[model samples]
Target chain A: MDLTDRPDLAYDVFAKACPSRGTLEHVTGRWGALTLGALAEGSLRFNELRRRVEGVSEKMLSQTLHALERDGLVHREAQPTNPPRVDYELTPLGHEVAGRLLTLIHFLEGRMDEVLGARERYDTARGGR
Target chain B: MDLTDRPDLAYDVFAKACPSRGTLEHVTGRWGALTLGALAEGSLRFNELRRRVEGVSEKMLSQTLHALERDGLVHREAQPTNPPRVDYELTPLGHEVAGRLLTLIHFLEGRMDEVLGARERYDTARGGR
Candidate 1:
């Protein structure tokens, strides 16, 4: 069974000590950026998602999706066909968050040059100071 | 000495495997959230930042600033006046990052209701499923 299709985790952003932090970790997790990027385009099967998001382990992908699904950001629909097909999409709220995340990603990619420069200065000053 | 003023850590976001991730941890770290939030308003002294962020421990705040400074996302200047006065501000790159972060924060705050609703459904369905 694809763990992404399971619904068990619950995220609470309001509470100070809620699972919200963990949920944030999952949503912004390393794979999360890629997963959300793919979902923003459209729903995809587990394997399809895996391809779109490179460098993700099957276990991490499954765990990330479970966490996102638990937060009600991503929706997981399982089709009961002979082989049991599953697809994932963003919920309305997920779309909002995805929009912001995409902005961050695009911004990061756009500013890669500046970030590179900053890294150099940071490294030099760090060594001296 | 305020750990925030020290320049030792270095962040490299480009490298697939570098201290970048941990630096990201510091910049986006839990307190990193508040630190950036405060710095966005304007350069602030460490104590002032501590007051504005609310509920942040001295250790976490210091660590967060140290990380941000290493990444060149924050500029720390120590004034050698009567008492050692230090102020922190966002570097140009930091300002860019902080802008996007603000967007995310505002978006999250605005969608709190929807996110809360999603949380409820997630919890209920999770219990049953």
Candidate 2:
């Protein structure tokens, strides 16, 4: 359903108990963001995703994937092969969400020098934190 | 400086040691995202911000602001008034980042029904989590 068709479903994220807040956490969470970003390139096996996201523990990646899958932002495909092949990919909705996230991610990545500079100045002024 | 002029600063968020990852976490963290979203409308005092972001404790809000300010994404202005008014607002860089974040946030807010539906199906399939 299109958002325009239902203005009544105005889910405000600012509200403490809003379901949107939970889903937003999942989308932007440490592991969740990286997992979605990795899948945006293409489908990848579970182990490949773990490698691509770096520093993610086996359990955390598993949890992150389950959250994204439940949110309908990821598709998990399990093959009945020898050892059972499992792959993860973004759904169409996932692609749109990941694209928006990447814009933010790339924007931050591009301006790291400024951020580092700011950190140094802030630290120097605070007598080094 | 434009990103085009700095091709060498390709800070990848997927890398474990990237500073960008830390900064990204501050931007997308539970309280951080809401704090930034609130400030995007305009400047606000510490108390005003606390009220607007809903559910954020004073301590957490203070911490979030400090991190954002250190990263150059937020500006903290302390007025030399009678009681001393401290206002927080997004810096130019913060504005750009917040705009990108709001896009992702609003997109998720608009599609929450789908997310909720998916959650129900997922829970039911697993005999309710």
Best by DockQ: 2
Clashes of each: 0, 0
Instruction: Score every model by TM-score.
Output: 0.74, 0.94
For each candidate in turn, the interface RMSD (Å) is 4.9, 0.6
Cα RMSD of all models vs. native, in order, equals 10.2, 3.4
lDDT of candidate 2 at residue A80, scale 0 to 100: 87
Q: Candidate 2's residue-wise lDDT over A2-120, tens digit each? A: 84676755688998888999999999998989999999999999999999999999999999999999998999999989889998999999999999999899999988989999999
Q: Rate residue A97 of model 2 by lDDT.
A: 93
Candidate 2, superposed: residue stretches over 4 Å from native = A1-9, B1-9
In terms of TM-score, the best-performing candidate is 2
Relative to the true structure, how large is the alpha-carbon lDDT of every model?
0.70, 0.93
Q: Tens digit of lDDT per residue, candidate 1, span B25-63?
A: 455556775578679889999999888776678998888
